[model samples]
Target: MLSRNRAAAARSMPGEGQRSSGRAAQRLLVALLGAAVGAAVAQADEPILPIPPAPALDARKLALGQALFHDKRLSNDNTLSCASCHDLSRGGVDGRSSSIGIGGAKGPINAPTVFNSSLNFRQFWDGRAASLEEQAAGPVHNPLEMGSNWAEVLGKLSRDAPLVEQFKAAYPDGLQSRNIQDAIATFERSLTTPNARIDRYLRGDKSALSPDELRGYQLFKAFGCVACHQGVNVGGNMFQTFGVMGDYFTRRGSVTAADLGRYNVTRNDADRYAFKVPSLRNVAVTAPYFHDGSARTLNEAVDVMFKYQLGRSAAAQDKELIVKFLHTLTGEYQGRSLQQADPLVARRP
Candidate 1:
């Protein structure tokens, strides 16, 4: 039954998901997958944005959260907010090699984009938090990150009459740090970017993308880049090592404390060097890439991924085309109004 399903899916799915239209694509995909892709091709039909959109944002709540996301007051020394690392205008990343935490502490890891982050299986590099609410509270409490103890942060929030009143209204249980985190997390959940050229193409608009973008998409699949980087988020649902068929960490040298990666969370040797794959949406805008932000240019990041993750190299032409296609992945936040209009956002001081 599975074989028949796969065979049928393969014959029908072409170019995004069609038959007559994607003969070339189907042929290429079949060649790349070597039969396995045929069976699971149907699975690819699923949209990547499974994350339920945040409930209609309460303006005061999201405004409050947005303020907090950019609020330096949440830091011990009033130096950093979520925006310090995850700047939305810059593709939701700050474009730094490593994020500067409280008191100018340089973190060992790159600041992952906050845009569309809610789609991940788990939050953070280590997959520690299970939900956005928990994840939002993480940085503030991280000694090196925000450096603000939740209790102290709560105390400060309590002092802000406007913030307190909004919080009170949002949560009948009354304002607390956890509630604040949930509100902010909800706001973050609304921070989704959609409608890239690829999206238009996926939705059956062939003219939405240029021919170069289409070729890049072909190269992306032909070279098997989508094996792990598939789905609506375009790569957040799975975890893989930096080097599957290569030695990425070894190439970099001795594993630093921060480079322990998933081992720190999983405490398993097999998990060493493993990290959750990041989303490619807005990747062109989010430069200074990777877990540690070692790659400064998107081209360099693509080169590194070719060498390490996919275990293959791209021809110069193919590389250029893929990079060009990658630019199309950048899109506008689909839920910005929710965040900006949330009562919580409006209510924040």
Candidate 2:
């Protein structure tokens, strides 16, 4: 009887061991499936893309546009040019909270950088202009901007024999307002800055980013910034409310017409405070950020995004890392680093 019992016990032990092994295998399979699902979620959530260089353009047209862009004669008082608001040497922005326009007039909104603007689906913070051509026509006639009618601008341009000759060379129809807009728009399209370190990293150059930058990028993705700020230009392709999680205007106080954002164009309450997401390319130098330019520094801008747009609190280290990642977005303009040519003028209190 004892021998029989030992034999049964030995057989049961092998069976029990087999069941245990099967359970271990099942757990392993479940873990692998979970890992795969997690990877898919991450990929779906964060899709980073590199910004390609601008396409080649006609040299004569590009030159003509650059001249027009810098020519102050476009303004009513001959005191400002496109360059006055968008300083090409300074990340394509004047580094002011609000642009100073004709007759020392202050613009209602911040001047977004012209660099890579061609990639945007629409122009302006409110997405009022459907194309760069339409956008070019805006400031020229805006009362606070260039403050000049198209007729006055054409009259001024027609007087310059060299400019007229160049215009004729560039456009078959010559220097009409439409042609001028076309030329300026074409030049603005050429103002793209490529070869950013972050772009290189996206293009599979692992060494392009440092350890901190890589971690910062991961954090940027993890924190859900990429939800709005994604794609080639990184945020220009869409519009989002300024404060998704909180009332930015109420917090800041003294809301202006500019704060209305896309509401001015749509006249819909739902569109209130909706603004075209500005591209993050060269954002480090385009300080005094947002439609109002309330955030003074990159760090402050990140903090505001977390508090208002993201509706979350982030550790100081995370914010610093995110800022470091943003710095990597600065790129080269015609083989040279795109940086502010001068220190930003102090904003008025």
Candidate 3:
């Protein structure tokens, strides 16, 4: 969370931007993390974990993850990466209901925003992967996604001495295959999207957001969308069947494996068609919506949610107000400076 790395790190707080270093230090952190995990397990209660301070973004891991994220070479046909589907400038999604991927395989779901995803309770449309570290490993090997084997990725990266050097500088254990994942994961954790005007307003600054956005917020709650999509990561903490007031699965038709959603992960018939309520922070940008990318516009998605879930229809003004409010959710990210700025990553040596 160094000031220089966060880019928008400055706020009204003191001691807000400092970087922690070394394997031993991180190991101490890991021990605490394990204890916290155990404590939560014992309680069987779900509490929001405080978002950790963004990890250091120096000239090492940041650079590596940045390269890996943007490098299409990670795909089998030299086609995609975490960035291909989730473009940073494009509100962290490719703006398709689903993007074309390796071997031109159409992804079964929409690419969720990478921004502030470190805050999500889980990864993917189903609440899976409990940590950002585990989530970071996903696309690298998904057959229809990047489609690259980690072993092959490791072999390719192992020959790059410069990448190895960057890894050593950023990771305490340095350059092992798993550590490469660690570096990329660490860099991704450092990627937090915050400081929206609405956040400031919610924090007590009355003038931070516009009147339209404020109206939108009210309509959001009154419509009871908050019942399923609430809490810090906004919506990632919970799961709900797609068509709750009515049968969404039956309506979807020609049901693909993707329609099974959480049921696919749990093997429970009751869980069928349940998907994680996605964070709507950047909804204005990431489009062709829904888990299956079935909705094409932000307004359309909002209308569908109202009709199917809330069992109400929004007035034109309310719909416009909500769209205005959604625009505030796009926090700024401009090709973030990485912990490492290695030429190898930039050049793909």
lDDT of the structure predicted as candidate 1? 0.75
The TM-score values for the models, in the order shown, are 0.80, 0.85, 0.76
RMSD of 3: 15.2
Better of 1 and 2 by TM-score: 2
The best candidate in terms of TM-score: 2
9-56 in candidate 3: lDDT tens per residue?
Answer: 554334423333455578899999997787656433322222234555
Residue 238 error, candidate 3, Å:
1.1
Superposing all C-alpha atoms, what RMSD in Å does each candidate have to the true structure?
13.2, 12.8, 15.2
Candidate 1's residue-wise lDDT over 211-268, tens digit each?
9998998888888888888787889888888888898888988678778778898799
Residue-level lDDT tens digits of model 2 in 146-254:
9999999999889899989998898888889998898899899888888999877765567999999999999999999999999888889999999999999899999
What lDDT does candidate 3 reach at residue 271? 87
lDDT of 2: 0.87
lDDT (C-alpha, whole model) for all candidates: 0.75, 0.87, 0.69
* Weakest ten-residue segment in model 2 by summed lDDT: 340-349
